[model samples]
Target: MNKVKENSVFFVSLLLTLIFIFWGVFFTENLTKVTNAVYNGSIDYLGWVYLGTTLFFVFFSIYLLFSRYGNIRLGRRNDKPDFSTASWLAMLFGAGMGVGIVYWSVAEPVTHFTTPPYGEGYTVEAANTAMKFTFFHWGLHPWAIYTVIGLALAFFQYNKRLPAAISSAFHPILGDKIHGPIGKTIDILSIFATVFGIATSLGLGAMQVTAGMHDIFDMPNTLFVQLLVILVATILFLISINTGLERGIKFLSNAAIICSVAIMLLVLMVGPALTVIKVFFNTTGLYLSDFLQMSLRFTPFGEGEQWIASWTLFYWAWWIAWAPFVGMFIARVSRGRTIKEFVIGVLIVPTLGTCLWMSVFGGTALDLVQGDHSLAKLITQDESLSIFIFFDHLPLSTLLSILGFAVVAIYYITVADTATFVLGMLSEGGTLNPSNKIKMTWGVIQSALAAVLLLAGGLDVLQTASIAAALPFAIIMLVMSYSLLTGLKNETVMQKGNKRNTQQN
Candidate 1:
């Protein structure tokens, strides 16, 4: 009790809870609507920029990793349950892919089957552009966001005397003055970015899950189901937050991965393995060959606004909203790693997961549509029902459905829990083992906030609002590029000077 008394986490948690409750009561629908407008209005070459920037970062990070910085290792480890290579990958996957696995694994693939990116001439076998599309969104650049954050924090805090936030990625150039109000401002902004980003995901994911329930079980798409999911998700988060990393988060993370993989296998056998593999190769090649052109291609402004919004803008908003949490979560797991190791494991491995997961899950869905027209109708009529309709095509529908739902349930737990856990750490100034009460507080806040948005705006409103917040943070992260470069050079030069003096003496 005393531990909870003077702690800022407790109060911050309370404040967030109140904010969520207040919004839930009155302004949720308003927030949802405003955000939607903001999101829809911003289209163009956004995907091009998102994809372009991500590619640049991926290449650039590889360059830096081979340089001297690549060799530097950081982080302080205690004997109890230290992290491993797999842990890093698991954490990265758990951070975003949990909710993502459930949501996009079906919706995205089907969306592409209907619209197929490279246009009408390509047969479904030759087309199925969704896997490539998912790969591009989920791949190297997003991981670079995480790589930069984790490397900076690991190097700064463990190797040097800096704090473990991504903003510290700039400390090498900024120097001691970074510790003043400037640092605090950056820190606060980081916190704000993380919250808004994850909030959108919470609302988006909760709504998706609710939609899934309605589709699968024929449950009414009611406010109550959304609320119940939010409430239940929050309770799980609180439990994991209190239990801390090893026991709570790890268990859920592993569970999610197992479920995800098992479902993929099931889908492959039941759906169509051969076609998805071929399409995966074809689309991946397409994604890679002209990566730069596509990444920077902001569909000509004159080209239909709706088309641009549906693809590029939506992807940009999703990535931007996800960056901070993914970045921070990557930082947390990335202590005691070299720059190269961190980048490859976090950025590369997860990209593979995204690509393959999309291939199998999305791939299977598309194959079914090609084989059976009714499958296409299910997708076009209701994106949420697409997964179950695919299930209906299978021989063992009952068993697969139970397994699929179980996977989704555990995945949601991992996502909601990890999100709340990261939030608590951010607000508490990067405490490794933050107070249980503090973690629980953020957990409850996130759950409540998500519930409100789900009830008022549904998925569209919830997701759009999160994207609106991304516009500003995008600039902030770009600014971070300058700060990181400036800081890195200064730190590097100073170290050389110190080494020279020691040799002379």
Candidate 2:
């Protein structure tokens, strides 16, 4: 009974996840119907909330960079950073994005070009718009979502000596209540969001890996192949989780970054090198000029509304759903960094890296698709094959495809590895070092959820699950910002009081 009471959050979250997996696996059609209903309703009614709240986080993150607390360290003043700067950037970038970026880099640009949000499709304007919006979707807004939540969690956990859980960030508002039902409820919500969000990525990774196999090795693109991909990646990530964060995840993250850069450079050298450079600069200008307009963009009474819902709103919700897992993972590794340093590292570095990636792969794809109706049609039929198809037009197609496979597979393992660690921390009452047993449990559950999502309805079902779980968590993140401010204000007051007392004595 005591053990159950102590680990009540774990037991409850596990039961909920198992129930969901059963529904997705057993009643696949009903699960699809219900999630699709929820997904559509969310877009129809609450789409504005997703846009507005994410924009607010962007502003809030910018505010913190220059706030009075900018110099405050995440841990004690004397504490030093655990990892080197390069390693830190690689790990956070790897955990925060990984499979999604690689999967989308070529696919999204080609997609937007063929079916843009506005104006005529398959025009030069459409190509320009495609790159601009890809930058927007993968840029500052998502990182802001990760930044504020991560900043709050790191502040409370390291500075205030609180547990390393989502609920702990609300101590200022919830007080002792954070330890009761309210706290457990918050953590449970986090678990659901993390599970589904990571599952979505896992499903995407499995699909893309399967696509690579089919394109390069002549393997059939079937459910069995996808499931096999997931199983193999699952075993690797589980091993990574057991090896702990410092060794397994760190090594893989660094390697993934190197491999990713290699692939990008190879594509740039072999395919439209000058066009990619021009596209990078041109799109950066457009992104800056139209950042605010696009940040709050919605088409309520117009032609592009459905497109916005399908693409922009979906991307926003996916990022929010991912916030807790990525945020906690980032905070875990960000001890001893000051607020200013944290923001630049977390927000600036990854956004620039992602935009550059989009420019390279997306630019090359755009250039290739010109006057090539069949290639465009092939991509339009299935986006998972976009990158592989793009490679077909390049020299040494076989080598490039193999390298791309390696990058995605590595990212797949790294993300699942990081996620299992974060899930373990959440389930074990925010312990920095959760036992291997707890980590293993979450690793298996997430892999199962990924497989079920794939089996149920493929990509559409995965997007719905992410958007459905993200709405509530977006609200939670907004509240967490206020709590963090309250905590910071109180800390300043206590410091001033102590200073006066010491002088008097």
Candidate 3:
């Protein structure tokens, strides 16, 4: 009874907080107006902080890779990885980005192309800038954020035998204070952030799924249709959660990767294969070349402030908000790997995959718009239908559209299943295997939150909620980086002492 009560602290606090927010948004008039006011206020004042912190995360992650601590194992020295390389990569990529990749692969580039930060609209210059910035948003920086959080959690939990929770990562910084109010607060915040972050993604997935249905089946893309899509997808994910991780998530992730690769191949074959290749390399080159400029960019001059706020700053906060769920899921599946392997695998592979995906989809869209001016207008009018519209210009459009819908559906399931698992673990005091009842409860709550947010204000509400949630968590992550470094140094000294003692004996 005592143990259950202790665990209930997190779950109960999170539930009540969510209830208050839901009431504020749905019941109270002008609540969303107030929310957006606060959201835009933060972006205007603190956009530079978000950009700078993300860059710091990227640098720190790279430092961990090449530092002496790189050789430190996450688990027992003799332990081996639980899953194969292929399976591991699939899960890592799947849970890290989810349906966003599908939704934005075409939409983002086109949106950028139409209103680039520093280029004329719908010209070659804008297209170039668009692809470059899209890569910037989806590339190394986001994965680096995930790497730091996952590394901290995995190191503390596995190496030190601490509880598998966010507060555990602060052990070096707070010591036993982690068991007090501070610790509880950190965990509570993590729970809230994870729920809101996943809810936002779920909301986006529902919108895209509705658009896809409208394209393929001639269904009306209305709020009612989107809610129905959410309901059906939620049911599917709940069923998936009951099957457990290995049987459900692993299988779906691998299958999604396969399908995604197939669709990419088809696009490459059918639409501007050479141009896609050339654009990929050129965009990659530009991204790397201007990486630093892009990383620290904020318009203090007030020239392009709104553009920066809408695109770059929003992405940084969104990634920060998502860090907890993606980070914890990565830690869960990444036991027994060395710190270097973990960093490299988590940071590089998925990023490369993202670049390739954007190249195929974004590249094709750019090519079509450049060749014909009308397609650019269509893209500007409805960004949701960008992928379907891009597909219509290719051969086997019907088959590819079906495959695209399947990939999105699978990604939706993976995100919900992974979020349920992580949320259960978090609320259950970091138990390795949380109860199915808890998982089901959180899953339902997540679906409800997504539905409510969609109805309240669609993408605007979701984005604001995510940014608000990210601010505090970003501070926590900064503290976590310090804790991880301190813990690694102590481990190094302890290991050397043991080695000397063994040699003398």
List, residue by residue over 310-405, the lDDT tens digit for candidate 2. 889988988998899999999999998999999999998899999999999999899988778679778767777888988988898999999998
List ranges where model 2 is wrong by over 4 Å.
Answer: 456-459, 497-505
TM-score of each: 0.87, 0.97, 0.96
Tens-place lDDT per residue, model 1, 1-505, is 6654434433544565466456545876666566666655554434445554555667767776777756555543231225766665776788856776666677666776666655652255433456666676666666676666555565666656665555566675566756655665565555555655666667666666676676568788777877887787777667677778878888788777777778788877776789878867877897898666656655454544465457755666567667767776766766767666776787667877788878877777776776666666676676545566667777678777777777767777777777766766666666666667766766666666666655555445555656666666666666666665565566678778988999999
How do these models rank on lDDT, best leading? 2, 3, 1
lDDT of 3: 0.86
**TM-score, predicted candidate 3 vs. hidden true structure:** 0.96
Ranked candidates, highest TM-score first = 2, 3, 1
Q: Whole-model Cα lDDT per candidate?
A: 0.65, 0.90, 0.86
Which portions of model 1 miss their true places by more than 4 Å?
1-52, 76-81, 121-126, 173-180, 208-221, 301-305, 490-505
Candidate 3 lDDT, 1-505, residue by residue in tens: 8876787656565666587566656664565676688778778787777987899999998999999999999988888988888998899899988788888888788888877898588888999999999999999999999999999999988999988888899999899888778888888888887887788788888888888899899999999999999899889888888888888889989988999999999888888899999989999999999999999886776688788888888889889988988999899888999999999899988889999999999999988888787887786677667788878878999988988988888888899999999998888888878888889988988888888877776456656766776876788888889999999999999999999999999
lDDT of 2: 0.90
